[model samples]
Target chain A: MSLAKRIIPCLDVNAGRVVKGINFLGLKDAGDPVEIAKRYDEQGADEVTFLDITASSEDRGLILPIIEQVSSQVFIPLTVGGGVRQVEDIRTLLNVGADKVSINTAAILNPQLIFEASQKFGSQCIVVAIDAKRAATPSGYGVFTHGGRKETGLDAVEWALSCYQLGAGELLITSMDRDGTKSGFDLELTKKISESVGIPIIASGGVGSLQDLVDGIKLGGADAVLAASIFHYGEYTVREAKTYLRDHGVEVRL
Target chain B: MSEIVIVDYGMGNLRSVEKALQQVAPLQSIKVTSDPQLIRTADRVVFPGQGAMPDCMRELKQLGLTEVLLEVANNKPFLGICLGLQMLFEHSEEGNTHALGVFKGDVVRFNEAQLFDECGSRLKIPHMGWNQVEQSMEHPLWKSISNQSRFYFVHSYYVREKEAIASGISRYPESFTCAVARDNIFAVQFHPEKSAASGLTLLENFVQWKP
Candidate 1:
């Protein structure tokens, strides 16, 4: 059988708790990270990613305890991201049980951090997260840092290509415009990046319904689709998403 | 309840394997250690692998668990996952590194040009995701699990071995060895912990297996 398209439930963590919100604003507490992860594992999530939104001023090490707790309870591929500034963070996360770590601001600050991280820990465990917003210019997307507060003037597609060449195994591209819109995924942005890179592209942001997930793979050509609200708010279960995708001939593991 | 020691040579996270074993067989005691002495006495041994072959071998040797690992694998009910399955082989093309030589073969990387599907769509490497596994031979590990059940996989290299020795098989572009079984040893390329229900069921069977 062909490798099935993956469905990942992203857990946004802050101050040792999993948090969620619309468009990365107005944060609301979900449940314990471990409990939520276990529930998603039982729900047949292909993988789980935790993004720590804790402010850097507070010691970032707070996420380690949460990682151990979640890794102990959930038996699946787990990825942790948000404030990974150095290679030690990657080592610490993987040591405690995270399969991979996503680096955004750090990668932007020091592009070589991507190459160095991949060298220390194989590329499979290094995921470069690019937060891209529509550039003011007509056609391309620009990279944003500090949680989409500042524009880096880097083209999303071009930056993604550079990340791939730097040994980043996977690219998690989030469309700031489409995030939390509950409208649909940024198919054009995802498709453009997916077509340019040889490595897998995980399309994230804006998944309101099952069809949105389906269109992500079929139209956007994403290797995996990451969603938050639909699964977190009880809008739909992971099984429901997989079953819907399978029924639509998308080949999800059902 | 029995002791299940997961040999961790510091290659990657052994927590998933240890936690999954706990989930599937809650009564059993699971330990993740590189202590050779503990491995020799464990009721069941899990050899979990991750990262690259060169680094994995370096740690396994540097930690001096090779003898104990071989001893348990030969007599104990040993289960290997992903890199664990690859490490048992003689060598890997990843870094031109020599393996434990538990199984006679080589682990080679997937050639991209040869990965075209029937429709000419190129499949990605690392084979990352879930896919249906076809059982090539009967085995107790498949107990309560369907024949063509989907399992999670994430790897760029694969083991090349005789189909006769393979307990299960799956394909991506083409067929390569996805599972191997012989006597007390059963190894798979896919992750049971991440495979959901059928995966948990297989782990449950392994815990109860008597070799």
Candidate 2:
């Protein structure tokens, strides 16, 4: 039987605090990651994702102490990303109770990293993250690396398939055009990758309401959904999001 | 003094349950424990849940609390919330996972056709909201709780009425069972703690409830 889709609350950490923005602009202090993660955990989130946006650019390790502290306090599965560029980085995060590690800029710069990490740690432990914006040309979406500022010539959908081929178990696709807009998810982008790949797809960016989450799963074919603004601002709790998905016929753990 | 012991399986929301219970019965003693012996001796036992049913079941079996829990359910006060409640069923459609079999039938997904109306309008999944609970019985556990009082719910799969041991129904798109009871065993589809004051009252009643 198919399991219910998961509603994940994303925490974009900068200097140990959670933050959110639109198209990665206009950043605001959300809260402490530990406190926010605990709140989501209590509200019945299937999983929690922490993206260290600043750590990636600085070429430093993730805030392992924060991850350890949060993991120790929270019981559900945790996925960490941002600045996770090396196999050793994956090892450290996993050792500290992170269930999975997501890679974006590193994967683009070195495609073999995905395969190598997956081979050493199993595909389930590795997640290939892709950030995209609507392409200027008619070919396809433009793949964005380095926190959605640098544009890669590669097509978004094609890159996702390549990651899967290289043994990546999951794909977390965020639409730069839709990030933090709360308008809704990039359904076209989500559906394209979901339909093209066998691995689970986590649709991120632009979730404004409960309907947006349901649409991401039903219309976009996403296996899970990730959002920041709606949840961070208390528009709806994670439990409410899951209940909405269930009533709409998505298989999720309550 | 009333003492409630929350079983620690390392898979669900243990702290929230403890905090909610404390608020409900301020004078009541509450302890979170993984030791099988402590659970066996506690006056009351609560099973809180999250994550996969199979993993929870496995953890319970590993800790050897499975038998102790079953014994307690047969003769003592027991409460299960959310996934904790679902685990009391015979099975769940998730991953072919088997439950404690305390209640009959398997927890399955809601009918997709009924999710939406003929016009293609559908209710969301996970059923996350503050919805009203329609009590099936005047069970003491719901003392001070009224018909219109809303409780918090966050579940994708629910127990159908036919297979339910005792049922309290709620409506999202349509009515479905949100709470279940069998002798000393009680389960709630919604989280009373997260439901604010109303939830705290329910937890208080559970604490004060004497078999």
lDDT of 2 by residue, B104-168 (tens): 76788766456642334344444544566778877888788786566666566887545546657
TM-score of model 2's chain A: 0.90
lDDT of 1 by residue, B156-180 (tens): 9999973357888888877888999
- Deviation (Å) of A180 in candidate 1: 2.5
Instruction: Estimate TM-scores for all models.
Output: 0.92, 0.60
Segments in model 2 whose C-alpha atoms lie over 4 Å from true places: A1-12, A18-130, A135-139, A142-145, A150-173, A180-254, B22-28, B93-98, B110-133, B143-156, B161-164, B171-174, B191-201
* lDDT (Cα, tens digit) per residue for candidate 2, span A1-254: 12346788888877665666312212243366677777788777767899887654543444677787776566555789988778888888876667678998889999999998876665655888999889973437879976578888888988988998997878999999898688999999998887777667889988889999999988998878998878776677788888888898766655
> Model 1: which residue pairs collide?
none
lDDT of 2 at A209: 91
Model 1 scores a TM of 0.92
- Best-matching candidate per lDDT: 1
Report, to 2 decimal places, the DockQ of model 2: 0.04
Residue-level lDDT for B132 in candidate 1:
84
iRMS, all models = 1.7, 10.1
